[model samples]
Target: MSEEPSARGEVLIVTGMSGAGRTTAANALEDHGWYVVDNLPPQMLRPLLELAGRVGSELPRVAAVVDVRGGDLLAELPATAQQLRDANNLRILFLDASDDALVRRFEQVRRPHPLQSAGTILDGIREERRQLQSIREGSDIVVDTTGLNIHQLASRTAELFEEEGAPRHRTTILSFGFKYGLPADADLVADMRFLPNPFWRDDLRALTGESEAVSNYVLAQEGATEFLDAYVQAVTPIIEGYQRENKSHSTIAIGCTGGKHRSVAMSLALAALLERIPGLRVRVRHRDLGRE
Candidate 1:
């Protein structure tokens, strides 16, 4: 979808270090509306592409996860990918991370590396790196997940495949409470706790932000409008830059003490203002609206 709409669909091969977040990248691609096939052998590339070719637009963007598990079949990837490069809109996305990061991830999951083979995790990583040298060099995109957490990795994956010139940038303005754990995926966080808690008001205690009265009350708070305006101004350029870099989605979390009233109202207000930014698609979602 990053290119013009055509009869042909795009094929992406997602591969690289085992603990380097290949699954996470595939999940991100799936969220971005791509059809993802995990742990595919290189030999199946032809059949899959052929199937997609027949299906046409229905299976437009396909991402296949390939890895060292293919054994000797792994050798076929370079040739196969090159053969389909021009005709199939083929791309290779290599996910990678530092050896230390990969080792830590494997340890946390209590799983040994696939190539460990009577050796340490570092040994498996080193062997995989050697095996993947040529493949990595041939890849169209190489993302290092060393510095990125899961959410950021997902955001990067979405951006990698976002179509040029499309209104692809999306912002989910989320409302939550501070008591619940922080949203691990949020890109921007705003605290609406400064506003008066509608939960404390007798008349509005049971009312939610969707109600006209609660929304008005929250928005009517002294600095509410100013904060909304300032936040909108601050994020406008950031969203614009994301588009320029092909980043497709962002989450802005608005939190109040209880999330039922203040955060939800501020979220709606921010969504309305953010929608005015030309390239952004805005939606408001309350994550902790009823979790009192």
Candidate 2:
């Protein structure tokens, strides 16, 4: 470890296992107003920072996406780490998924892992994990995307890196279905199954939670408003403390038997409540809305 960088722009060193949603993360960072260099070699790391320093406020935050594709050049990261430590300005967001997930992704894309020679995909994944172990251990944040959808992974990326004038922390109020399994990254979960299902009603059956009828029906349940009030009261202080602790990303999974009606309504209602809290950003996603 070294002394933190003083008053310099921040740099995000993004790396990890192959097919672990690095592309999604990089894209999200770019969308978050970061100057992103995709697949940049580690040897250029210092030059990039120097360039950013020269540019000053023009580019206050930069994210470099480094991967196995850099081969020998990737070895320069440890040296770069030493230089960045003092500024306390470097953050490595290590994106990783399970071996099974990586294999599936590689197969789906009809591409072989960069480390794979003549061996199986699993062999390449194993080698990549070994090669990345040291850097991963030293990373500032580790995001496991094994069970997250592309949208969810993108949401995580946004949560991790906040733009200037944006909220310091983000809360993703995700609505999911029990049938599709839980969101692997949700920090907290709420079940809405106790409420009456809109799927059973003829008129609401064809409508989503965003529809006024469905929203009204879902909110009219005996304990619906009470739940939102109670949950907001409970989670508000937790997020305040989270921001105080420098934790940036949080997922609150709200679920029902099916994702379309009750959970979606409740997620919207919850988000409505959370939005009133200062400095806390919220995004609502219906994970299984159309799957039904």
List per-candidate RMSD values in Å: 7.3, 11.7
Candidate 1 runs further than 4 Å off? 1-7, 165-274, 282-292
Candidate 1 per-residue lDDT, tens place, 1-292, comes to 2332232788889998898889888887776778999889998987888888778889988999999999988988999888778677888999899999999999999999999899999999999999999999999989999998876787687767856654657889999999996899999998998888888899999999888999999999899999989988899889988776657789999998878889888898888888888867888899988774
Clashes of 2: 7
lDDT of 2 by residue, 73-182 (tens): 77777777777667548889999999999999999999988898999999999998888888898898999999987777877787778765787578999999999999
Candidate No. with top lDDT:
2
Among the numbered candidates, top TM-score falls to 1
Q: Provide TM-scores for the models.
A: 0.61, 0.56
Clashing pairs in 2: 3-86, 4-86, 4-87, 4-88, 5-86, 5-87, 5-88
TM-score of 2: 0.56
Give the lowest summed-lDDT range of ten residues in model 1.
1-10
lDDT of model 1 at residue 181? 69
